[model samples]
Target: MEEAAAWLAALDAGSATREEFEAWRAVDSRRAVAFAQVADAFEQIERLRTVHDPLPEPRRLGPVRLNRRNLLRGGVVAGGIAIAGGFAMQAAAREHAETGVGERRTVVLEDGTRVSLNTDTRISWRIKGETRSLWLDQGEIALNVRALAGPPLRLSANGMRFDLEPGAFNARREPETVALLVLKGTASAENRAVRVGALAQAIGRDISVHPAEAVAIDRARSWQNGQLVFEGESLDFVVAEFNRYLDDKLVVADPRLSRIRLGGRFTNTDPTELLKALDASFGIRAKRGESGAIMLSAS
Candidate 1:
């Protein structure tokens, strides 16, 4: 050990440099392994210094519970694969069970209620007698709360609570701001009950609840039945919803293009067909995004 310490001192003092270390490393792979160990130690220490103690774990509830929590639509979203800390996530190492990029997941809950998780989604839920409760922390998810004689089912997400009445439907989340879209069923957005044909949107410090003449249900299950239901919608609204199920998001560069009315039934996974229909029927050109998302601007 004394001789090893002396050697290190000599190296630090310019008697030896990285050239000497590389020569040593090359002679026996052990030297290279030793250097890597040192580097790893340094990196771990730096990471520990950067992160505070309290970091929440990624949450997941899988296909385990039959009537309690279920991953719908023949989609098996494996449990949340979390990294301990201090490194970027490797693409291959990450495991996610999700609907397609813009697709939907229609899962049948244990109590006969149905849930449709929107694109880029994850959820944790547990069923308790008399009162059904779940957490929708991130992503877009819809719920069709079965008509239960028991207490109302509660959904909490984005700092808001959704009291799903019997035969009520709702989709809401808070990432940047709180947004709730209610159609067919009733959902409590913010504090008010939003019924069929209503859309309520909320952001931090601001909430808006109004009775609208129209509603939009961006459901993944509807496509299985060969329907893309759009209710009193604009061109951009339909395009964006289409992007969620299709691999590409539509890019609407023109501001005015957003206002045109859009109502149609189109097949899922066929954005090109939808665009062609739009062009043929509406005379709008659809440009292609880098990843093939159709972008519609004024032609």
Candidate 2:
């Protein structure tokens, strides 16, 4: 097991060659099994770290003595293969759903849970007997969870887990944080409860919850209606939000234009109307850049 851990660490660090790994694993059949177990344990530890601790102190592993009894005990030869195969089956059972840029889609899970995906979003879910898990890889989604017997819906995003009651919620994943807005019912993460009109923003293990403002809640609802409702938001903020749904992104070329406040409802798909409004109201020019980005600058 110690050797397996050392090999795994070396592989992870990109210091181990493929030829060297194959030669080492060929020495003993049990060595391969031990290495698989060590790799699995490492993966499980990483997942736990993401959920419980963002930055944990490193700890060195002590010496581990291996024996024939230890190798054979748990039917390691047969059980190791079974465990590896089981993981493959579990992955296959998950149904993946995604949306491209400027696209929106709604999906109904096997358990009747409705999920409305925003642009450029990726998610996978498995709804089977005694298993209800959804993984949000990126982007945003609004979920209307169905009431089902047994355990509540388990949502995993950015390695954080939230057990949600039958309710409506909007979740968005950014580069550094995951934001959850509870529209109805409740959700619990790390033993903290989040009720309706509450917003929970998680940065690793640190999660903070507060009441969502009326505009924020309304914005969440408007996305499903193919619109973006901005109420006196900064030009920079509105541009960033609009870029999410656009392949040809909006860029603020002038720093002076970023702080300008604007408010209105606009279609999520096209930025033409918003650009015209900016030009008409604030003398902001929208020019098509070489890279096809819409550059916003003062006229």
Each model's total of backbone clashes: 7, 0
Best by TM-score: 2
Worst 10 residues of 1 by lDDT: 79-88
CA shift at 218, candidate 2, in angstroms? 0.5
Q: lDDT scores for all predictions?
A: 0.55, 0.79
- Candidate 2 structure, TM-score to reference: 0.73
lDDT of 2: 0.79
lDDT of 2 at 76: 45
Alpha-carbon lDDT of model 1: 0.55
Model 1 clashing-pair count: 7
- Candidate 2 error regions (>4 Å): 1-86
lDDT of 2 by residue, 134-242 (tens): 8887899999999989888888787567889999999999888999999999998767899999999999768999999999999999999999999999998999899
Write candidate 1's Cα lDDT for 167-247 as tens digits.
Answer: 645555647665555566677654577877666676654667776543345443364454567766888778766765555
Report lDDT (Cα) of residue 11, candidate 1.
37
